[model samples]
Target: MINAQAANPFGEQSKLLETVAAWTLGLLWVLPLLYAIWTAFHPAEFATRFSLTAPLSLQNFVNAWHAAPFPRYFLNTFLLVTMILAAQIVLSTMAAYAFARYQFRGSNLMFMLVLMQLMVMPDILIVENYNTMNLLSLRDTILAIGLPYFASAFGIFLLRQTFKTVPRELDEAATVEGASALQTLWKVYVPLAKPIYLAFGLVSVSTHWNNFLWPLIVTNSVESRPLTVGLQVFSSTDQGVDWSIITAATLMTSAPLLLAFLLFQRQFVQSFMRAGIR
Candidate 1:
């Protein structure tokens, strides 16, 4: 009984340590975001000075918004993300269908090559991709930013997994009803896999919305600069970086996506859960 009591105390201590560790980690991650929020609204002088006494103002946001063509950047980002997601969805779905449903010879080899892209991303081939973009006459265009993401290996893999999880009995039933493969895919598989589609779409939208490197390399002017690229200008001024203004600009750049995720948090979680199940 004394040994049992000692073991119980050790277990309780371990649980207490785990709880403290979890809270510490959570606070560590949340602190930076909280600091950004603080800097975005605080005066320039108070940006680095952590204080509850700082008076919040909307002036920094207004100044940052007017200093750059943020509206244009936001519009460009929206258009680019939409274009990329739309193209990726269509291409990945078709490719996933082929991989999941068909048994063509050498299919495994082709799929392995496709999956290889997820490891060695297009960004890593920036020079070649940029040259290809130039050759296509899409340089300095949103199309250039959206082009490389047109076929997402990750999306194809996710959708293929989801599609395979769909019961073959549905395909057989539709076949017996004289439905073509396309019809069965559209009516049977696609409908059942809506959650995975949503999950993939969310993943695509979030990723492309924040993409900076390729867009920065390809886009020369404000005409094609996405929000992330645009925010860099405010953060990296030659004269001096205005921390408050830069933070405000960063906040403005991320606000739309942040708001969207906040609003759809439940849906996002549910979709991801379904995708994981598949």
Candidate 2:
């Protein structure tokens, strides 16, 4: 193997270059996180300085928490994410089931329309969505922030693909046992699509949690503003920029998702892998 590698000098050089590029990119991504951690744990005076002897403290976190209405922000974010995820799952499941199992006059056309939606970026419809929200009087509400995302093309597509992989015999057997369409879905398709659901859930949660543009535009009040919007408002020019406190608040903003990912990372990875391989 060593001799073969030595003979393929160009291939070896390409791999070496790729490794270097990967490490460089990884460091670039991680440096800011390291800086945040350092600043969040040390005194403000040490924010720009690196010293092994610097005293570690949680005062920054305390100051950040006291500075903003973080509890309300957290509540808004939780409600927003949960409401969106639940609605997406229900709507996607029913739509995907119909597309995967039953056929109708406009089934193909409808499915094609859904596929077309996948091609259209949500940001492109920001104006239309905003206008609709205003018409519905849902502006500045958590429901308004989640309403546009309730029908997720990506979720429907993923679940449809997963549902299609189930055997026809099982579906027929469930029907023969006097199960209705919804019953069959709950007992058969849903159980089999657990991994897809999990993967989709993670994607939905992460996407909505970090979403900024739509929320910032839609929400104008503290009661409806999510963490991302709240954080942006807090870090704006109106508020004095203290790196230590800002970094602490940033960490606090991201902590729930980060901790959840750390705890379920293995499951998250496995679910995606299963969905992909299927």
Candidate 3:
């Protein structure tokens, strides 16, 4: 009884420690976002000062919006993300279907090569991709910004795993109904993998939406510049840093992704769970 009582106290102490650690980590992660929210809403004088009577104003947002071509940047980013996602969905779907269903020679080798790409950082290929874009006379174009990312290795790998989980009986049943291979894939495998598709689409969209370095390197004109690049250039002007306006612009640029996550958070979690993601 004495030993049991001692062990119970130790277990409670461990649990208390874990709770404290979790709260600490959560606060650390949220600190920057909270600071941004504080800065974006208040006037410049109150940006670094936290006061109960601090006046909130939308003037910073207005100024930031008018100081640059944010609308054009938004349009370019939207087009680039949509185009890349569409191309990735089509290419990854077909490649994954072949890798999961076919028995061709060298198929395993090719899949292994695809997997190898996931380990390599994309920034390492920026110079080569830029040179190729120049050769094709596609420099400073939205297409150039998205061309290298159209065929995603991660998307192929993810879809292939989901496709492999599907049963062969379903494929054969579709074939018995006189459906073509494409029809079977669309009718059988695709429907069953909806959760995986949603999960992958979210990932692809978020990655490209926040992608800055390659877009900055590829696009030189306002017509093709994305929000990230535009924001960076706006914040670096000769007038020096204006924290209030910069934070407001940052919030505006990130609001779409934030709203998307907030609205679909439940679906996002459920999709990942159903897809068996760890």
Top TM-score hit: 3
As a TM-score, model 1 comes out at 0.91
lDDT, residue 94, model 1: 89
Give the TM-score comparing model 2 with the true structure, all chains together: 0.92
Cα lDDT over the full model 1: 0.87
For model 3, residues 1-278, the per-residue Cα lDDT tens digits are 57875868788888899999999999999999999999999999998889999988999999999989999999999999999999999999999999999999999999999999999999999999999999999999999999999999998988898889888998889999999999998989889878778878888888999999999998899999999899986567898899999999999999999998888888888877866662
Off by over 4 Å in 3: 1-11, 276-278
TM-scores, all models, native as reference: 0.91, 0.92, 0.94
Worst 10 residues of 2 by lDDT: 231-240
